[model samples]
Target chain A: MTTTIEPRSGTAFKLGKGQFLEVVDPQGQQVSDLLAFNAHDTAEVISNGRTFDYADTIYLTTGHVLYSNRSNRLLEIVRDDVGTHDFLLTPCSQDTFRLLYDELEPHQGCFGNLAGVLAPFGITEDEIPCAFNCFMNVPVDGKTGKFSVEAPLSKAGDTIVFKAMMDVIIGLTACSAPKSNNGSFKPIDYIIHDHLDDVA
Target chain B: MTTTIEPRSGTAFKLGKGQFLEVVDPQGQQVSDLLAFNAHDTAEVISNGRTFDYADTIYLTTGHVLYSNRSNRLLEIVRDDVGTHDFLLTPCSQDTFRLLYDELEPHQGCFGNLAGVLAPFGITEDEIPCAFNCFMNVPVDGKTGKFSVEAPLSKAGDTIVFKAMMDVIIGLTACSAPKSNNGSFKPIDYIIHDHLDDVA
Candidate 1:
């Protein structure tokens, strides 16, 4: 199944074991926050901290495994068009914008988008975990120990794919941080393909 | 309702808005990991990063608010018998034990207890975010930039209370890190009181 998450919006879909989900950055300079939860158990959701510890890298690319809080592998990155993805930062929220930019306007953020999209699954805002920011440019300065977000390096149609290790629920948000990029947001597409039959 | 979670075990319960949950270290010297999820929306669950940033303190005490990923307030610490709490570390998992101790035997850890306790609620390991390590003595050294876990300072019957800002599901794990404390673990009790009726 395929889905398109519009700018400032979010969507959720299920990927059975042996299935692969490919997320496409339809337009360059857009960041997508991807979160996943064990379909059989909501408590076993993706954990950025564990993933980083397991991979021993701040940046994620193909071959990296997204580990859950229990240190279990949930998804494995099987393909990537853009090699850089951020697993260190939490999703952008209203408070982040308010505290950093002092902009009081109700701007769209990944927090709200994830909450809305997962609500149908009986998931609430408090259940939202840190997400993997794909196609976003966040560079760390080794000398000063500082990091800054820049425009994405991916071009149109750039893609990243992950194979589900178990039945899982995936949530994606087309980040609406206008200032993070070129003062505009764009949509992203995702496709989930089942390969269980082939494995059988 | 009241529940006593045995040492190295866990329990999950829900508290409505205006209700308060009190956790008591009946035997003292015990560390408990407290995790909260928005009962209405799990995606906005408590976030240690946001809470620390909001309170501007590494330690949690009375009057501090536990903020969610969406930056929404989830719970407020209305009372604290032991003022020190660690919000900087993730719960200990089997992987952590293996990596640190190199002991291959099955060891009890906060991650497993949480997953088991919240299983009935469909919560899995991935949903367990960085926890508020209640009564756990993890002190950071300013000179060496190092921290070590020590035995808790709280005495028997020491208690901490949190008033729910929203409907919330709380998970508590009696940490099973034997070496972190004395050579054994102790149980903890929790009581939930509905204050909404009193308010009305």
Candidate 2:
């Protein structure tokens, strides 16, 4: 099945073991937040710390495995068009917005989107874990270890695919950074397929 | 109300605004993991990063306010006998135990206790946030910027009192580090009281 996640919005879908979920940047310069939870047990959700530790790299690309807090493998990256994905930053939230910009008006962000989309599955706001920012340009300065958000390196139609290591629920949000986007914020598309099917 | 959390176990309770919860190390040398979530909305749980950022210190003590991920005030430390506490480390889990040691038998840990205690309140394991380790001695070396878990500095009868900023649910687990503890792990006590009462 295929779906288009609108800008500043998110969707949740179940990906069975051995299935593939392809996240595509339908338009270049856009970023998406990807979060996953074990379908059978939500406590075992995607953990950035474990993923980074297991992968031994800050940046993720094809052949990397997304690990849960339990150190269990959740997904294995099978394909990647853009190699610069971020696992360091938390999803943008209202609190972060106010902290960074002093803005009061509620802006659409990943935290709210993840909360809204996962509510039906009994997932609440507190359950939202740190997400993997696919196609997001957050570079860490070597000298100061400071991270800066930048425009994505992906081109239009760039995609990354992950094969599920277990039955899992995947959440995706088209990042909503009105001020940070280089020019425009755009939507992204996702496709889930059976591993045995050779769609490529 | 008063409660005792057995060693290697945990319990959950609700604290309303204008109320205080006192966590006591009945027999010193015991550590406990304290985790809180918004009673009305779970998403606004206590966040270690925000609390550290707001306090501008690595150690927590009397008068420090615990902040949630949303930057909302969750708890205020009104009284403390042991000023040392940990906000850097996550609750120990089976995954972490196996990673660090080759131990095959599943030993009791904070993560399991939190999950078990909060299950009745509909909090799944995924919802368990990074905890505030009370009475735990985790010291960081300034020069190398490395943290080492040491024996707790708190003595028997040491206590910390937190005033609820809002209606919140708290989960506490007595540390169950069989081999890591200097000697042995022990149970702790807790008491909830209304701020208007002077029961002391």
Give me the candidate number with maximum lDDT. Answer: 2
Winner by TM-score: 2
The C-alpha lDDT values of all candidates are 0.77, 0.78
lDDT of 1 by residue, A118-193 (tens): 8887776666777888887766543322356678888988888889998989999888777555678798888876
lDDT of 1 at A6: 84
Q: Give me the displacement of residue A64 in model 2, in angstroms.
A: 6.2
Candidate 1, superposed: residue stretches over 4 Å from native = A142-145, A195-200, B1-67, B70-89, B98-102, B110-127, B132-200
- Models 1 onward score TM values of 0.62, 0.66
Give TM-scores of chain A for all candidates. Answer: 0.93, 0.94
Docking tier of model 2: it is incorrect
Predicted complexes: DockQ each? 0.12, 0.10
lDDT of 2 by residue, A1-74 (tens): 66898888888889999998899888787888899999998767887656654554567788889988777999
TM-score of chain A, model number 1? 0.93
A119 in model 1: Cα distance from truth in Å? Answer: 1.4
